[model samples]
Target chain A: MAGQSQQINISDLDVPQLADVRKQLEEELTHLTNSFSQLKQAQAKFRSCIDSVKEVAPQNQGKTILVPLTNSLYVPGKLSDLENVIVDIGTGYYVKKTRAEAVKHYEGKIDYIRTNLETLQETIQKKQDNMSVVASILQSKLQAQASDKANKD
Target chain B: MSLEARLQAASSEYARLQAELSAAVESRQRLDAQLSENELVKKEFAVLTPNNTVYKLIGPVLVRQDPADARATVDKRLEFIRSEIKRVEAQLTDYDARTEKKKDEVCLFCFPPLSRRAHPPLHRQLVQIQAQIQAQGQHTAAATAATA
Candidate 1:
């Protein structure tokens, strides 16, 4: 009993213990929700990368554009290389890829993040179900105790 | 050592172990992120043609690199990160076991069973004595009524 794992019924727990479990579940849910939002933000970033790659088409070659030297600094420059763009692969490495290839790379990243979001959503749903179950059981226990006290009085 | 001192020591040890374990876990998470990033780069490298160029960013410039050499570098990094993760995992498990043992020691010191049995709580003893006196008074009242 001391070393082995055993499942205990939540209904058997007193009010304070049930409240503790609820609090823990609430914390986990919030953490998972934060991760979900972060993943969504990443997906948005990848989508924007795809759009930026598409914007640099061959038709736009030799066009004068305001290039960003800094966040608030833009320098007027002519677009020279429309066929190949330097893609920032992870770990501070960049690869020179054609326009189509850059789009594909960003698409792949978006797909990976989508899969992760799905799994995270499923986990959050399961935790929510557990939370509701614990909450209902706690409510019923409290009501029973209240009625018992009333009858004794 | 006194029980209080032992409990204090055990609790402090547990806290230290917890801090170290969290640090190890954080590093493991960082390594995992690095591993995944490298793997993504490796995948991109796989689909590259010989004409495609790879560059490593240094300070402020991109230096052209041989695709094969870049692949090798990424592979080596992945291997290193994998090894680091394994070592950290082992450390985490060891810390987990140590913390569990320390927690048990602290609990034993806090609620020593022998001391509890030898000297039950004062309120409980008082309650037992009061019940015994009430029972005796009731018995004496019944005896007087019988004599009358």
Candidate 2:
């Protein structure tokens, strides 16, 4: 009978119930904070990649380069045609493109990610604000209850 | 909505947001890893000279490609990653907003931050419930007096 309904009145909750609610909110806050940091890290990495692509494009035409076999290893390589570009079209297929097309593609991608990052930042701020509000309300309510009990005693 | 319905809706919304956030974080990690790999490929392209052999995978076959072509493909991949990240992030943001609104709606009592004008229907519902409770209590008292 006690577990039949899930309705809860926050104002009517006793100390034990409030403590349970607080625990849940704290967990959610922790999860959101972790997600925010991870998103930030991803944004930073994306920005760095864009910058590197921009800087490395014009200067590398017809120059000797080493390709990475692994993170810490590389093999000797060179570009036979500066104008010809290979693009992977998924399913293990490759297509051809010009250097300009490649640059345009990455630039378009950068714009898309930038918009996404901005929206995500706003959401993160909202979550943070919500968490703080919840925490403060819970703190004051607990304190108020304690003082009420003291006055009566 | 009734309190029970409102509570259920809010809990569901919170759960959905949690799932969406988790998925977004997972996709971000995957995109970050792809970016790291492409960064290395871009580095390789920066130092490419004429006659350097670039191998590309075509249907499980490693075919030799021009260095320029390989770099273009790498750039395209990086851009694809960017698009994916954006899509996931947008979903995350949307879910976050919904979750925020649901949280506020459910905790209307704990956090009476909602203005009366903004929550007229809910305010009406609560007032109705309070009046009903008072009426029931008075009726019970009258019955007890009659029995005595």
Candidate 3:
């Protein structure tokens, strides 16, 4: 793919043709960069979530807690065993885990997301570099075309 | 094919790929957010004892749930989310590969294949440029207002 695009001699194209190509590159690059930032934002939120869970887990241990009965009501309750926990994974599903084990699970998720973010960042950089090269070639061609028009006139 | 016709075809394909990529990314993020929420709940559940009264929200009411039952439910949910995340990630990977392929085939110049990155339709570029100009103008106006 790289070889095919590189083979195009920019000097062979006229001003309008070069401009058309440059415009397309700019739009595509804009889209790529936009998505990259969005992915970064999601990763940051996930990290903060992990930190919050880690901070709150220890304090709740062995405590007789007030369970919520409704949106605004609470019922007093005590745990039979502090060592056990039921985690709602999603879509009304539940799972059991120890507090320490749950924290480790979240930490592992954070690590996985971090790795994904890193890979995406690398790809964004490569796309940006490719866009810049295209821009440079387009600019030079446009400049040369202007000079040719001036000489002819 | 004429340059105009070829440009139209490539631009349309690029536009399609752009939309597909955005949708895939959005879905992936949503799934990740759901997973994070579940993990946080699991932490809370961990500190709870088996004999603790757990309230499960059934419809508008918080129905009493057996701690054992709650644990099993959450276990199932966690498993489902794990599988879902894998599925969504695979879909995202597939979309990313297709987008990359499309980009590679798109050569910016008059080449047969448009470079994977460049060559939007002229009208679309004009509209984008105009929008940017309008946004810049608004930014300056807001800055002046702040100064005033």
On TM-score, the candidate that comes out on top is 1
Between prediction 2 and prediction 3, the one with superior lDDT is 3
Give the range where candidate 3 chain B is weakest over 10 consecutive residues by summed lDDT. B139-148
Give lDDT tens digits, candidate 2, residues A17-106.
556545554555565556557756765765664554454465676677888889999998876666656544333434454555555545
Model 1 chain B poorest 10 in a row by lDDT: B139-148
For model 3, residues A1-153, the per-residue Cα lDDT tens digits are 423656976557666655655555555556666766776776677567556555445456666678788999998886664564544444454445665655665566567667767876776687678667777877787677789899999
For model 1, residues A1-153, the per-residue Cα lDDT tens digits are 211257787788999767766776676677789989999999999999999999899788878899898999999998788888989988988999999988988998899999999988998998899899999999998999999999999
Per-residue CA lDDT of model 3 for B23-47, tens digit only, reads 6566666777777766766655666
Error of 2 at A6 (Å): 9.4
Question: How far is B70's C-alpha from truth in model 2 (Å)?
Answer: 19
Candidate 2, B43-103: lDDT as tens digits: 6566555644456786667687776777788789889988887887787678657756755
Question: For residues B65-110, could you state the per-residue lDDT of candidate 1 as single tens digits?
Answer: 9899999999999999999989988997897688678657655554
Q: Model 3 reaches what TM-score against the true structure?
A: 0.45
Ranking by lDDT: 1, 3, 2
Best model per lDDT: 1
Q: What is the TM-score of chain B alone in each candidate?
A: 0.75, 0.64, 0.68
lDDT of 2: 0.59
